[model samples]
Target: MRREAMRHRLTEEFFARHSTVVAPDLIGKLLVVGECSGRITEVEAYSGADDAASHAYRGRSSRNDVMFGPAGHIYVYFTYGMHFCANVVTDTVGVANAVLLRAIEPIDGIEQMVNRRGRSDNLTNGPGKLCQALGLDRSDNGASLLSGEIGIYDDSWPDRSAGRAIVVSPRIGITRAVDFPWRWQLAAERNERNERRRPGGSRTP
Candidate 1:
Protein backbone atom coordinates (compact mmCIF):
# COMPACT_ATOMS: atom_id res chain seq x y z
CA MET A 1 0.00 0.00 0.00
CA ARG A 2 2.80 2.40 0.82
CA ARG A 3 4.52 2.02 -2.52
CA GLU A 4 1.34 1.97 -4.56
CA ALA A 5 0.06 5.10 -2.85
CA MET A 6 2.71 7.31 -4.41
CA ARG A 7 2.38 6.12 -7.97
CA HIS A 8 -0.18 8.54 -9.45
CA ARG A 9 -0.34 12.29 -9.63
CA LEU A 10 -3.58 14.11 -8.99
CA THR A 11 -5.14 15.26 -12.22
CA GLU A 12 -5.31 18.92 -13.22
CA GLU A 13 -9.05 18.87 -12.72
CA PHE A 14 -8.48 18.27 -9.03
CA PHE A 15 -6.90 21.69 -8.74
CA ALA A 16 -8.68 23.68 -11.42
CA ARG A 17 -11.23 25.25 -9.11
CA HIS A 18 -11.62 28.12 -6.74
CA SER A 19 -8.93 27.94 -4.10
CA THR A 20 -11.53 27.94 -1.37
CA VAL A 21 -12.82 24.63 -2.63
CA VAL A 22 -9.41 23.14 -3.27
CA ALA A 23 -7.83 24.19 0.02
CA PRO A 24 -10.10 22.28 2.38
CA ASP A 25 -10.18 19.32 0.03
CA LEU A 26 -6.40 19.04 0.10
CA ILE A 27 -6.46 17.97 3.73
CA GLY A 28 -5.36 14.37 4.33
CA LYS A 29 -3.75 14.02 0.90
CA LEU A 30 -0.15 12.88 0.54
CA LEU A 31 2.47 15.41 -0.55
CA VAL A 32 5.33 13.44 -2.12
CA VAL A 33 8.79 14.88 -2.76
CA GLY A 34 11.12 12.25 -4.09
CA GLU A 35 11.49 9.91 -1.06
CA CYS A 36 9.90 12.26 1.47
CA SER A 37 6.16 12.33 1.99
CA GLY A 38 3.63 13.80 4.38
CA ARG A 39 -0.09 14.04 4.93
CA ILE A 40 -1.45 17.52 4.32
CA THR A 41 -2.83 18.80 7.60
CA GLU A 42 -3.63 22.46 7.03
CA VAL A 43 -4.03 25.01 4.23
CA GLU A 44 -5.18 28.58 3.61
CA ALA A 45 -6.74 29.82 0.42
CA TYR A 46 -6.04 33.08 -1.41
CA SER A 47 -7.77 34.70 -4.34
CA GLY A 48 -6.65 37.26 -6.86
CA ALA A 49 -7.74 40.90 -7.05
CA ASP A 50 -10.69 40.21 -4.83
CA ASP A 51 -8.51 39.12 -1.97
CA ALA A 52 -6.48 41.84 -0.40
CA ALA A 53 -4.18 39.37 1.28
CA SER A 54 -3.14 37.69 -1.94
CA HIS A 55 0.12 38.59 -3.60
CA ALA A 56 -1.62 39.17 -6.89
CA TYR A 57 -4.37 41.26 -5.37
CA ARG A 58 -3.00 44.45 -6.88
CA GLY A 59 -1.72 42.91 -10.10
CA ARG A 60 0.90 40.48 -11.34
CA SER A 61 4.59 40.87 -10.62
CA SER A 62 7.63 38.81 -11.44
CA ARG A 63 7.41 37.05 -8.11
CA ASN A 64 3.69 36.31 -8.32
CA ASP A 65 3.39 35.48 -12.02
CA VAL A 66 3.14 31.79 -11.26
CA MET A 67 -0.15 32.31 -9.46
CA PHE A 68 -1.68 33.39 -12.74
CA GLY A 69 -0.59 30.23 -14.47
CA PRO A 70 -2.62 27.09 -14.94
CA ALA A 71 -3.65 24.82 -12.11
CA GLY A 72 -1.63 21.94 -10.66
CA HIS A 73 1.53 23.98 -10.20
CA ILE A 74 3.53 25.30 -7.26
CA TYR A 75 4.16 28.99 -6.41
CA VAL A 76 6.90 28.99 -3.82
CA TYR A 77 7.95 32.27 -2.21
CA PHE A 78 10.52 33.40 0.31
CA THR A 79 9.22 35.07 3.42
CA TYR A 80 10.68 36.81 6.49
CA GLY A 81 14.08 36.79 4.82
CA MET A 82 14.94 33.41 6.31
CA HIS A 83 12.10 31.06 5.40
CA PHE A 84 10.35 29.78 2.32
CA CYS A 85 6.63 29.14 2.13
CA ALA A 86 5.05 26.83 -0.42
CA ASN A 87 1.69 27.34 -2.09
CA VAL A 88 -0.29 25.38 -4.64
CA VAL A 89 -1.55 27.40 -7.56
CA THR A 90 -5.15 26.75 -8.43
CA ASP A 91 -7.83 27.95 -10.89
CA THR A 92 -7.30 28.10 -14.65
CA VAL A 93 -5.00 30.25 -16.72
CA GLY A 94 -5.30 34.02 -16.24
CA VAL A 95 -6.94 33.59 -12.85
CA ALA A 96 -4.80 33.95 -9.75
CA ASN A 97 -5.57 31.74 -6.79
CA ALA A 98 -3.51 29.59 -4.47
CA VAL A 99 -3.54 27.55 -1.29
CA LEU A 100 -0.78 28.01 1.18
CA LEU A 101 0.44 24.76 2.70
CA ARG A 102 0.39 25.61 6.36
CA ALA A 103 1.38 22.28 7.81
CA ILE A 104 2.02 18.63 7.07
CA GLU A 105 2.18 15.46 9.13
CA PRO A 106 5.28 13.50 8.29
CA ILE A 107 4.70 10.18 6.53
CA ASP A 108 8.12 9.38 5.02
CA GLY A 109 11.77 10.38 5.09
CA ILE A 110 11.74 11.40 8.72
CA GLU A 111 15.49 11.07 9.08
CA GLN A 112 16.16 13.51 6.28
CA MET A 113 13.72 16.07 7.64
CA VAL A 114 15.18 15.84 11.12
CA ASN A 115 18.70 16.20 9.82
CA ARG A 116 17.78 19.28 7.79
CA ARG A 117 16.02 21.03 10.63
CA GLY A 118 18.28 19.78 13.44
CA ARG A 119 15.17 18.93 15.51
CA SER A 120 12.12 16.71 15.28
CA ASP A 121 9.14 18.00 17.23
CA ASN A 122 7.11 20.75 15.58
CA LEU A 123 9.27 20.33 12.52
CA THR A 124 6.43 20.75 10.01
CA ASN A 125 3.86 22.62 12.03
CA GLY A 126 4.12 25.87 10.06
CA PRO A 127 4.42 27.01 6.47
CA GLY A 128 8.08 27.94 6.68
CA LYS A 129 8.92 24.89 8.70
CA LEU A 130 7.19 22.52 6.32
CA CYS A 131 9.00 24.09 3.36
CA GLN A 132 12.28 23.70 5.18
CA ALA A 133 11.52 20.15 6.20
CA LEU A 134 10.37 19.29 2.69
CA GLY A 135 13.33 21.07 1.11
CA LEU A 136 11.22 23.55 -0.88
CA ASP A 137 12.62 26.86 -2.03
CA ARG A 138 12.01 29.59 -4.58
CA SER A 139 13.65 27.43 -7.23
CA ASP A 140 10.69 25.08 -6.96
CA ASN A 141 8.34 27.87 -7.93
CA GLY A 142 6.20 27.40 -11.04
CA ALA A 143 7.02 23.69 -11.08
CA SER A 144 4.28 21.46 -12.40
CA LEU A 145 2.92 19.21 -9.69
CA LEU A 146 1.61 16.84 -12.35
CA SER A 147 5.22 16.22 -13.46
CA GLY A 148 7.75 17.77 -11.18
CA GLU A 149 10.03 17.09 -8.24
CA ILE A 150 7.06 17.60 -5.90
CA GLY A 151 3.49 16.43 -6.08
CA ILE A 152 0.35 15.99 -4.02
CA TYR A 153 -1.10 12.52 -4.13
CA ASP A 154 -4.05 10.71 -2.66
CA ASP A 155 -2.60 7.38 -1.62
CA SER A 156 -5.35 6.83 0.92
CA TRP A 157 -8.45 8.53 -0.36
CA PRO A 158 -10.49 8.75 2.81
CA ASP A 159 -9.64 9.07 6.47
CA ARG A 160 -5.96 9.35 5.82
CA SER A 161 -5.59 11.05 9.16
CA ALA A 162 -7.02 7.98 10.87
CA GLY A 163 -10.55 9.38 11.31
CA ARG A 164 -9.48 12.85 12.26
CA ALA A 165 -12.11 15.29 11.08
CA ILE A 166 -11.45 18.50 9.19
CA VAL A 167 -11.98 21.99 10.60
CA VAL A 168 -12.23 25.45 9.04
CA SER A 169 -11.51 28.92 10.27
CA PRO A 170 -10.18 32.31 9.17
CA ARG A 171 -6.76 32.37 7.64
CA ILE A 172 -3.91 32.91 10.10
CA GLY A 173 -1.55 35.88 10.47
CA ILE A 174 -3.18 37.78 7.65
CA THR A 175 -4.40 41.32 8.23
CA ARG A 176 -6.71 41.53 5.25
CA ALA A 177 -9.28 38.86 4.52
CA VAL A 178 -8.82 37.90 8.13
CA ASP A 179 -12.37 36.60 8.49
CA PHE A 180 -12.76 34.86 5.14
CA PRO A 181 -12.87 31.37 6.66
CA TRP A 182 -10.32 30.24 4.11
CA ARG A 183 -8.29 28.01 6.38
CA TRP A 184 -8.90 24.27 6.54
CA GLN A 185 -7.15 21.59 8.52
CA LEU A 186 -7.46 18.11 9.94
CA ALA A 187 -8.40 18.40 13.57
CA ALA A 188 -6.10 16.68 16.05
CA GLU A 189 -8.70 14.77 18.08
CA ARG A 190 -10.66 11.98 16.51
CA ASN A 191 -14.44 11.33 16.36
CA GLU A 192 -15.57 14.02 18.77
CA ARG A 193 -16.57 16.76 16.32
CA ASN A 194 -16.81 17.24 12.58
CA GLU A 195 -16.48 13.51 11.99
CA ARG A 196 -17.32 12.35 8.49
CA ARG A 197 -18.16 15.90 7.53
CA ARG A 198 -16.02 15.54 4.44
CA PRO A 199 -17.24 13.52 1.46
CA GLY A 200 -15.03 10.47 1.94
CA GLY A 201 -15.04 9.25 5.54
CA SER A 202 -14.12 5.59 5.29
CA ARG A 203 -10.58 4.52 6.02
CA THR A 204 -8.48 3.33 3.09
CA PRO A 205 -7.26 0.32 4.99
Candidate 2:
Protein backbone atom coordinates (compact mmCIF):
# COMPACT_ATOMS: atom_id res chain seq x y z
CA MET A 1 0.00 0.00 0.00
CA ARG A 2 1.11 3.56 -0.68
CA ARG A 3 1.79 4.52 2.94
CA GLU A 4 1.70 8.25 2.34
CA ALA A 5 -1.49 8.14 0.31
CA MET A 6 -3.20 5.99 2.92
CA ARG A 7 -2.10 8.36 5.64
CA HIS A 8 -4.97 9.57 7.80
CA ARG A 9 -4.16 12.99 9.16
CA LEU A 10 -6.19 12.54 12.33
CA THR A 11 -8.42 15.20 13.84
CA GLU A 12 -9.43 16.14 17.36
CA GLU A 13 -12.55 14.04 17.21
CA PHE A 14 -10.27 11.11 16.61
CA PHE A 15 -8.62 11.83 19.93
CA ALA A 16 -11.82 12.27 21.88
CA ARG A 17 -13.03 8.84 20.91
CA HIS A 18 -12.52 6.10 23.48
CA SER A 19 -8.83 6.24 24.43
CA THR A 20 -8.70 2.49 25.05
CA VAL A 21 -9.80 2.09 21.45
CA VAL A 22 -7.12 4.44 20.16
CA ALA A 23 -4.23 3.52 22.46
CA PRO A 24 -3.35 0.00 21.33
CA ASP A 25 -4.49 0.71 17.79
CA LEU A 26 -1.76 3.34 17.54
CA ILE A 27 0.85 0.63 17.78
CA GLY A 28 2.87 -0.18 14.66
CA LYS A 29 2.02 3.36 13.53
CA LEU A 30 4.33 6.01 12.13
CA LEU A 31 4.89 9.55 13.36
CA VAL A 32 6.42 11.59 10.55
CA VAL A 33 8.27 14.88 10.66
CA GLY A 34 7.41 16.78 7.53
CA GLU A 35 10.38 19.12 7.54
CA CYS A 36 13.13 16.85 8.87
CA SER A 37 11.85 13.60 7.31
CA GLY A 38 11.89 11.82 10.66
CA ARG A 39 9.80 8.80 11.72
CA ILE A 40 9.05 7.40 15.19
CA THR A 41 7.94 3.98 16.50
CA GLU A 42 6.42 4.06 20.01
CA VAL A 43 3.40 5.84 21.52
CA GLU A 44 1.20 5.73 24.69
CA ALA A 45 -2.28 7.10 25.49
CA TYR A 46 -3.71 9.12 28.41
CA SER A 47 -7.45 9.32 29.02
CA GLY A 48 -9.31 12.43 30.17
CA ALA A 49 -10.15 13.71 33.66
CA ASP A 50 -11.12 10.31 35.02
CA ASP A 51 -7.78 8.75 34.24
CA ALA A 52 -5.76 9.17 37.40
CA ALA A 53 -2.51 8.88 35.43
CA SER A 54 -3.37 11.66 32.99
CA HIS A 55 -2.06 15.16 33.31
CA ALA A 56 -5.61 16.27 32.63
CA TYR A 57 -6.75 14.50 35.80
CA ARG A 58 -6.86 17.86 37.59
CA GLY A 59 -8.23 19.85 34.66
CA ARG A 60 -6.38 22.25 32.32
CA SER A 61 -3.34 24.29 33.09
CA SER A 62 -0.97 26.68 31.31
CA ARG A 63 1.19 23.62 30.68
CA ASN A 64 -1.51 21.21 29.55
CA ASP A 65 -3.77 23.78 27.88
CA VAL A 66 -2.84 22.66 24.41
CA MET A 67 -4.27 19.25 25.14
CA PHE A 68 -7.71 20.86 25.37
CA GLY A 69 -7.43 22.54 22.01
CA PRO A 70 -8.40 21.02 18.68
CA ALA A 71 -7.12 17.51 18.16
CA GLY A 72 -4.12 16.62 15.98
CA HIS A 73 -2.02 19.25 17.71
CA ILE A 74 1.26 18.58 19.49
CA TYR A 75 1.54 18.84 23.29
CA VAL A 76 5.17 19.04 24.30
CA TYR A 77 6.29 19.30 27.89
CA PHE A 78 9.64 19.65 29.65
CA THR A 79 10.47 17.04 32.31
CA TYR A 80 13.42 15.39 34.14
CA GLY A 81 15.14 18.78 34.36
CA MET A 82 16.62 18.09 30.91
CA HIS A 83 14.27 16.37 28.47
CA PHE A 84 11.18 17.35 26.53
CA CYS A 85 8.36 14.84 26.05
CA ALA A 86 5.94 14.95 23.12
CA ASN A 87 2.29 13.94 22.97
CA VAL A 88 -0.54 14.21 20.47
CA VAL A 89 -3.52 16.14 21.68
CA THR A 90 -6.63 14.01 21.45
CA ASP A 91 -10.40 14.42 21.95
CA THR A 92 -12.62 17.34 20.90
CA VAL A 93 -12.03 20.97 21.77
CA GLY A 94 -12.33 21.61 25.53
CA VAL A 95 -11.59 17.95 26.39
CA ALA A 96 -8.12 17.54 27.78
CA ASN A 97 -6.71 14.24 26.52
CA ALA A 98 -3.59 13.10 24.70
CA VAL A 99 -1.31 10.17 23.82
CA LEU A 100 2.25 10.33 25.04
CA LEU A 101 4.73 9.09 22.43
CA ARG A 102 6.83 7.02 24.77
CA ALA A 103 9.44 5.65 22.33
CA ILE A 104 10.24 5.23 18.64
CA GLU A 105 12.09 2.55 16.69
CA PRO A 106 13.67 5.17 14.41
CA ILE A 107 12.87 4.73 10.71
CA ASP A 108 14.07 7.76 8.69
CA GLY A 109 16.24 10.83 9.04
CA ILE A 110 18.23 8.81 11.53
CA GLU A 111 21.29 11.01 11.25
CA GLN A 112 19.31 14.10 12.13
CA MET A 113 17.59 12.31 15.01
CA VAL A 114 20.94 11.04 16.24
CA ASN A 115 22.51 14.47 16.13
CA ARG A 116 19.56 16.02 17.90
CA ARG A 117 19.45 13.30 20.59
CA GLY A 118 23.24 12.84 20.96
CA ARG A 119 22.88 9.04 20.95
CA SER A 120 22.09 6.37 18.37
CA ASP A 121 19.61 3.72 19.58
CA ASN A 122 18.71 5.86 22.57
CA LEU A 123 17.44 8.51 20.18
CA THR A 124 13.91 7.14 20.26
CA ASN A 125 13.81 4.50 22.95
CA GLY A 126 12.14 6.55 25.70
CA PRO A 127 9.62 9.38 26.07
CA GLY A 128 12.30 12.05 26.36
CA LYS A 129 14.38 10.28 23.74
CA LEU A 130 11.47 10.37 21.34
CA CYS A 131 11.22 14.17 21.66
CA GLN A 132 14.91 14.56 21.15
CA ALA A 133 14.91 12.19 18.18
CA LEU A 134 12.17 14.22 16.52
CA GLY A 135 13.86 17.51 17.30
CA LEU A 136 10.83 18.48 19.36
CA ASP A 137 10.88 21.08 22.15
CA ARG A 138 8.52 23.52 23.79
CA SER A 139 8.41 25.36 20.47
CA ASP A 140 6.53 22.39 19.01
CA ASN A 141 3.80 22.57 21.64
CA GLY A 142 0.40 23.20 20.05
CA ALA A 143 1.79 22.73 16.53
CA SER A 144 -0.69 21.01 14.28
CA LEU A 145 0.12 17.41 13.47
CA LEU A 146 -2.19 17.60 10.44
CA SER A 147 -0.30 20.53 8.93
CA GLY A 148 2.53 22.93 9.54
CA GLU A 149 5.81 21.14 10.41
CA ILE A 150 5.02 17.90 12.31
CA GLY A 151 2.35 15.23 12.09
CA ILE A 152 1.31 11.60 12.59
CA TYR A 153 0.84 8.79 10.05
CA ASP A 154 -1.26 5.68 10.39
CA ASP A 155 0.66 3.84 7.71
CA SER A 156 2.04 0.98 9.79
CA TRP A 157 -0.23 -1.33 11.76
CA PRO A 158 1.36 -3.70 14.24
CA ASP A 159 0.37 -7.37 14.15
CA ARG A 160 -2.36 -7.14 16.75
CA SER A 161 -3.79 -10.48 15.71
CA ALA A 162 -0.56 -12.29 16.35
CA GLY A 163 -0.78 -14.58 19.34
CA ARG A 164 0.89 -11.86 21.34
CA ALA A 165 -1.44 -9.33 22.92
CA ILE A 166 -0.92 -5.59 23.28
CA VAL A 167 0.46 -5.15 26.77
CA VAL A 168 -1.81 -3.05 28.98
CA SER A 169 -0.18 -1.83 32.16
CA PRO A 170 0.28 1.22 34.37
CA ARG A 171 1.64 4.51 33.09
CA ILE A 172 5.37 4.87 33.57
CA GLY A 173 7.40 7.49 35.48
CA ILE A 174 4.66 8.56 37.86
CA THR A 175 4.49 8.24 41.65
CA ARG A 176 0.88 9.11 42.41
CA ALA A 177 -2.15 7.09 41.27
CA VAL A 178 0.01 4.10 40.51
CA ASP A 179 -2.92 1.74 40.59
CA PHE A 180 -4.58 3.03 37.44
CA PRO A 181 -3.99 0.58 34.58
CA TRP A 182 -4.02 3.20 31.86
CA ARG A 183 -0.69 2.38 30.26
CA TRP A 184 -0.39 0.19 27.14
CA GLN A 185 2.59 -1.64 25.73
CA LEU A 186 3.40 -3.93 22.78
CA ALA A 187 5.93 -6.63 23.56
CA ALA A 188 6.23 -8.16 20.09
CA GLU A 189 9.91 -8.41 20.63
CA ARG A 190 10.36 -9.83 24.10
CA ASN A 191 14.07 -9.74 24.75
CA GLU A 192 16.33 -10.07 27.76
CA ARG A 193 16.82 -6.32 27.91
CA ASN A 194 13.10 -5.63 28.21
CA GLU A 195 12.55 -8.58 30.51
CA ARG A 196 15.08 -7.37 33.03
CA ARG A 197 13.34 -4.00 33.29
CA ARG A 198 9.65 -4.77 33.42
CA PRO A 199 7.08 -2.05 33.84
CA GLY A 200 6.98 -0.52 37.38
CA GLY A 201 10.54 -1.70 37.89
CA SER A 202 13.44 0.62 38.74
CA ARG A 203 13.90 3.69 36.60
CA THR A 204 15.68 3.43 33.25
CA PRO A 205 18.83 5.39 32.70
TM-score of each: 0.88, 0.80
Clashing pairs in 1: none
Candidate 1: residue 86 lDDT (0-100) = 92
Q: How close to the true structure is residue 116 of candidate 2, measured as C-alpha lDDT?
A: 86
Backbone clashes in candidate 1 total: 0
Candidate 2 has what TM-score?
0.80
Per-model C-alpha lDDT, please? Answer: 0.86, 0.69
- Collision pairs in model 2: 12-71, 15-91, 16-91, 41-104
Residues 1-205 of candidate 2 have per-residue lDDT tens digits of 5545665665545556655566666666667774443333345677767777778888888988898888778899998799998887777788777888786566668888878877665567788777777788998888987776676666534423245556777776887677767666656354314222565655456
Candidate closest to the true structure, highest TM-score = 1
CA displacement after TM-score superposition, residue 143 of candidate 1 (Å)? 0.6
Q: Which stretches of candidate 2 lie over 4 Å from their true place?
A: 1-8, 11-13, 35-42, 156-164, 190-196, 199-205
